[model samples]
Target: MLDRRKILTIGGVAGAASVMPLARLAHGDSTENGVRNATSHHHHGGKVTTRSVAANAAPPLDPFSVPMPVPQVLRPSYRTSKLDQYVLDIQPANVEIFPGFKTAALTYGGTFVGPTILATEGRAIQIKYRNRLKEDANVHLHGGHNPASSDGHPMDVIPAGGSKVYTYPNRQPGATLWYHDHVHHLEAEHVFRGLHGFYLLKGYDEARLNLPSGEYDVPIMLRYGKFDEDGQILFSPYDDVSTRTTFLVNGRPQPYFKVAARRYRFRLLNASNHGDFKVNLGGREMVQIASDGGLLPAPVSRKEVLITPGERAEVVVDFSDVPVGSSVVLESEWGPVMRFDVDRRGFDTGGPPAVLRPNPTLPKPTVEREIRMQLSDDQQVFWINGKPFDPDRVDVRIKRGTTEVWRIYNDDSDWGIDHNFHLHMVRFRVLDRDGAPPWPGESGLKDTVSVPPGTSVRVQATFGEHLGRFVYHCHMMEHSGPFQMMAQMEIVQ
Candidate 1:
């Protein structure tokens, strides 16, 4: 999701700051201290330390493989919920990371990020989720291959104490996805409060990538969370809504990992509630191998990759030359993410693959169309195409497997709001920016891209082959509420 909560600034009030607290609107279960619902922080510290410490060290674990020793792990299940409650308090607490600083996070399972839901493509996933907080809530699977019933339809509230089961068949190939609250009125609050987790879809194609195996690739989710002076987590209230200052990688505030000094593959997910991140390995560059939908034609070597909320990148970093005790920091232009401390141990690692599986590119859009998006602000209303969202209306439709170009013009002329455009079903290649080719990092296929104020972007992609009701909209939770800032796409057979 992209357009976060929009802050309303009221000016010219005499001694307004000294006035008594206005009657706080009842949002579910707000703390007496007056907290508002807000999206969680994105990241902090340095880049991940998943590289090897030596050229001949044992490799890292493969996130795709579920070990036999832990075979009893829960298989994917189905469930649901209805928006009922409000004011949920998620704790962004600390956890041990061997020699690293205790990481802090807003979590439902006491971890920075939740566990992964392993599933086979083309199957049903049912989730019966409950909202224990004092406000309404909902959940959207970041990139689930499913139907509308499971897509967390906007404004479909799961009231506090209420529950809803999301049921949709998984139809896409292997990829790293995520799920988080998508409540219409209080999305920022719920997600910022830690109601998100990772969801993985495994398929036969990924098995053929030949990039890394058994103990070489890992899924590392990067997010940020905040805490209060009282040692409890600090969440955004409707009034004080904005991104936090601190950053986090995989739920840790500032953690480090030990490496054997070999080549390691990392699947990076920018799960931040509302932060634009340019991931860089301290002073070094990265070989970006894949993006949202899966592997690219081959690795694209670049120094920095700017990942927005709900975006993912697959990259390989070689740490075989770093000396023991020397540490490498994974950082972004925004803040440091995490550290990789190379150990004396070493191992012979496999080199980068020359030919990776590439998505079959369809012919250019035979039916050319343009979408002009505007992030305008009125007294309290936000819009797309100068109109609010209305479920009665089906925004766009396309035939299965047809390619098209979506030109998004961010007309923040009046309001100039930063908007993140997220589309469902197929991933898209950023064709150009201001009519020119995009940067290397921006050239890959993606599910979400931020349309900064006063700028425009064009994306080319095909629709899923399945017939169903899918959606495309601004990911900013607050901007996308009832009757405002959202649209739908129906794929016909």
Candidate 2:
């Protein structure tokens, strides 16, 4: 527990939202969820319970002025023959994000950007998470095949001053999974306060390929934020992101990183609340070696990688031929995000034979289903198929050894809201998007897919292993929180 007077905590709106599709409706924000799925007419505007207003600032920042801070790979507290043990303290810290301002935030393991946790493929692992916050905290290993007991169910919380040890079977293949807070309604607020980290699995197909390792391998988190005059991070949950123009990489604005003139493997995760990234290496081509579920069957060459919120893409960039002291800036639509400085002479030990592994196929579909991601006309309640989240209700039930193809749609796209679909416990193969084939880079196994406004996505998934309660929802926290657009499916024998 933190000493009462030690950590300086910043106060924020208790139950505000992050992205409101109708930016104009933000003026009237409140604590009421409004007759929850009931028909409208409770018209009280933002004047009712509005909080302090801050500036929509684009801080004056120099491109490449600061060197990117690399997160250290956390060493386990101890290890036995079966599994590794780790302790994560969820608490508050004042981190220096901007050049001269220290942003007070909630962190995991004391890192503004949560540090990476490495585990071996197919080996069991135990993580003891301690909640030092005033509220609840739990870790959801995104992209992991964890059992329902350890899957970070929103209500399976480690309350303030409490602790729990979650054990993962690690029975799935090696993939670039992540850990983030998944507390029911406060997900948006908690994650925005910085509770995310990389959890990568090694020793599977990726091991045979001998991909870039050691210093050459990097994990970078990308997101957008809005700050106030004194460099304090601002959170206006009611606003529809019209003011969040400042993009950041690993919590810094346009920082530069020193990389060797050799092949490097960069694992990229989109940790933002609602932003999608169009990653480009300044016109240079890179190969996509992995997606949300890890190493692809074969490398796909691409000029840009499109990744959405809650998705991960791992690419290998070869700078062995570039001249020393030269730099290539990584840019998105908002301009320079980070710069990679190649200032050293190094050998390029090309990785993995042309082919790393074969693409595994899923069993034929034995069941089919559809769910609509929607919102009420008043926009106060979010729901799936006209109903908000009800933890007591089992929306759908599936037999343990069956495959299902889900037709997920963004039904509220009429309001210009973009949503994506995510399933817990198992990774699925995307069949297509809107009856057409998915992008070449998205062909690999994934647990999340973007269902654009007014469109639908088809995916084939199998629930052959774990049996218990799991959830499917719009990974966008705003919709998941205030809108309540999520449902549960139980796996039974």
Candidate 3:
């Protein structure tokens, strides 16, 4: 077994010296600490001696050869009249990620990717989260409609060995949501360490639609990671850069799922820290039934879906015509992600509904906001509207329950890459992208949208009952930090 103390020391050393300098520059602070630390910073808000790890000492772990393991859906320990409660402990463990190779990883509930939380609309959820690791962390229910207190604001951190109860009033419609670490300056490192899980909200409207259920409904989470010679996870401390090489679906690398010759509902989430997947289903047409927020008005067929970090899409694939002994591979631009082996035949009575859900009528905009995403000339820093994330600064303030149009511009042409725009607590509709109507998959409600370089996208939303301070930022975790592309908003009465 690898020495826990030694690994901690090595991680600290590798992060502190190399990563902290950029972070300090971003935050305008001399020192800070969390899970990923540098020589100038500490860990879990404690002082620790730091050293440097030789980058050339270890060989990189092979991305292939590990059979995929399907993630297990988490069952709540108990339920009450008004609350569904769960307990999660964040800690470190060693698992066989590669064949016969024990890779050290940080996990939630003692798994590589945390357990999936199945929730229902109108039911409140109370999660008692305990941090047993050696660093500070907190949980963010991404794409949730809840009070700011439970929004996992970066400033609202849980220190090492600390615990907190996060409440989510599941009042929104059925959607594919997720939870992960959201520490202010260390979100990238914490998430890259495997602190993410799915939170699927089931609603009466969706349940009544008679979509695929039980084993036919699958949740696929895509992520990438890097491993060292000793099979330990390695996180880069560089600015605007990541070291992801392996692709995983629901915590498994190139895993294959056995499916029946019928239609299957796949809830797809792009959970990578900084990568995007332009997924192609081996030339098979995928019917996209929903986007981030919920069901679309009608199902749209598409050949490919470009899912970036922090975005989710609900797609259905009909395999009724495939031979029983056939195999279908899902591929990204790089290579195959996973496979579906037709092992059985079953009657699929349900198909995509002609009409899914009624679109909410958005009131006239009472406020118009413009936000810009820019990268420094050197591409070392990211900024929002010419300003980096300032905890003390409130970028926008508005009256609660009012509709607004936010025009987000991605001005990062220096690197010629796209940036993702995301907001907390409320869902929005894509008014247009670059003056064109929203694409098929983007027509539904959404909390996150992709903004390509040199383009602007306009979105409209009504700020609902939840009031207080919330955030709007890039979904690329590495692009969100103390001095990165993020801003705060206040909803006033």
Candidate 4:
């Protein structure tokens, strides 16, 4: 085993230029227009500076090179009010990713990837989080409908060696939510070092649907990162655009899972710092039962599901007819994600119900706003509506319980690149995309939506009971963090 103490002592290097050229050298892919302007104005004291560089790429690890390791399903060690209480210790440790390669990692509860927290609706949850690393960190329950105190605002951070207790009134319906580090400026680096996990919320109505359960339910957390020759994780402390050469599912590279010939439910979470996935299953149709918000009115069948970072989608796959001993692979544009081996025969009694939930009634709009996404000429700074993030400034003021339409446009000039929009504390409905009705996959409620290059997306939402301050920004970590694409909104009664 690798020495955990030694690896934890090694600090991460700062600056984007230090690791920019390595991606081109390793992948030979010139498509990525890396940070063209290496000099950032935000450097302390306004002095032009750079960090000493090092080799940041390891030999490419082929997918399915090793058998898949199913992540251990975590049952909360404590619970109350039908809500689970977990004590997560965030610290640095070394994990054996490949057979012989021990990679340095920052984990929750000493695991490379944090354990899944299964929650039920109408309950209350309390998480006692302890930050043991050298840097500040905080937890954000993505897609949660909690008060400002428990929402993981960037400014609400716990210093190293400090602890905090977060309370969540689990009032939202069943959805595939996740938890990750959300410290203001260091979110990219903290998440890149492996500070993310799954939070699955169950509802009484959803349980009645009779979807796949027990052994058939699986949580697939997708992540991407690069490693050094010595197996240490390499990341650009100042750049969010650094390329990742390795892809993983539940912390393993190219793993395969053994499945019975029956219907299975897969809860997918895109937890990468960057990169989006266009997922398909060997040309097999997948029934999408829920998106970021929760269950749709009915299951939507489609050939592909496009999932961006910080997004979640719950899908069901029927393997009843697949021959035993046959293998099927789940793939994305990058390459094969993971393989599924049908090794056992079993009876499949569960199928997608015709109706999953009632469609929400959108109220008439009381206000409308437009937000334009752009990049600075030097491409070092990202802007939302021609302004950067200012914690002291509130860009928009909204009335509680009123409906509003937010028009988000991704400037076409930034071609070949797409941006995603995410709003905290509320689930929304996509009114239209590029003036057309939302695609089948986007018809349901969502907390995040893809704003493709040159296109505009209109979303409507009726602010719920909670009223305070929240944020809306691009989901691209690089853009939202160092580049400043985030903005604040105030909710008034």
Best by TM-score: 2
In model 2, what are the clashing residue pairs, if there are any? 17-237, 27-46, 28-45, 28-46, 382-483
User: Comparing 1 and 2 by TM-score, which wins?
Assistant: 2
Runs with alpha carbons beyond 4 Å of true place in candidate 1: 1-112, 121-135, 157-168, 237-243, 364-366, 377-379, 399-401, 413-416, 465-468, 481-484
Clashes of each: 87, 5, 7, 3
State which candidate, 1 or 3, has the greater TM-score: 3
Model 1 is weakest, by summed lDDT over 10 consecutive residues, at: 11-20
Query: For each candidate, what TM-score against the reference?
Result: 0.74, 0.88, 0.85, 0.86
Model 2's number of clashes is 5
> What are the C-alpha RMSDs, in order, of all predicted structures?
11.9, 8.8, 10.0, 8.2
Poorest 10 consecutive residues of model 4 by lDDT?
A: 4-13
Looking at model 2, which ten-residue stretch has the lowest summed lDDT?
A: 4-13
Give me candidate 3's TM-score against the actual structure. 0.85
Give the candidates in order of TM-score, highest first.
Answer: 2, 4, 3, 1
What's the residue-level lDDT of 292 in candidate 3? Answer: 94
The lowest-lDDT stretch of 10 consecutive residues in candidate 3 is: 28-37
What C-alpha lDDT do the candidate models reach, one value each?
0.57, 0.75, 0.75, 0.74
Residue by residue across 225-325, what tens digits does model 2's lDDT show? 66676667776445435345566788776689998888999999888877677789988988888889877778888899878789999899998888999
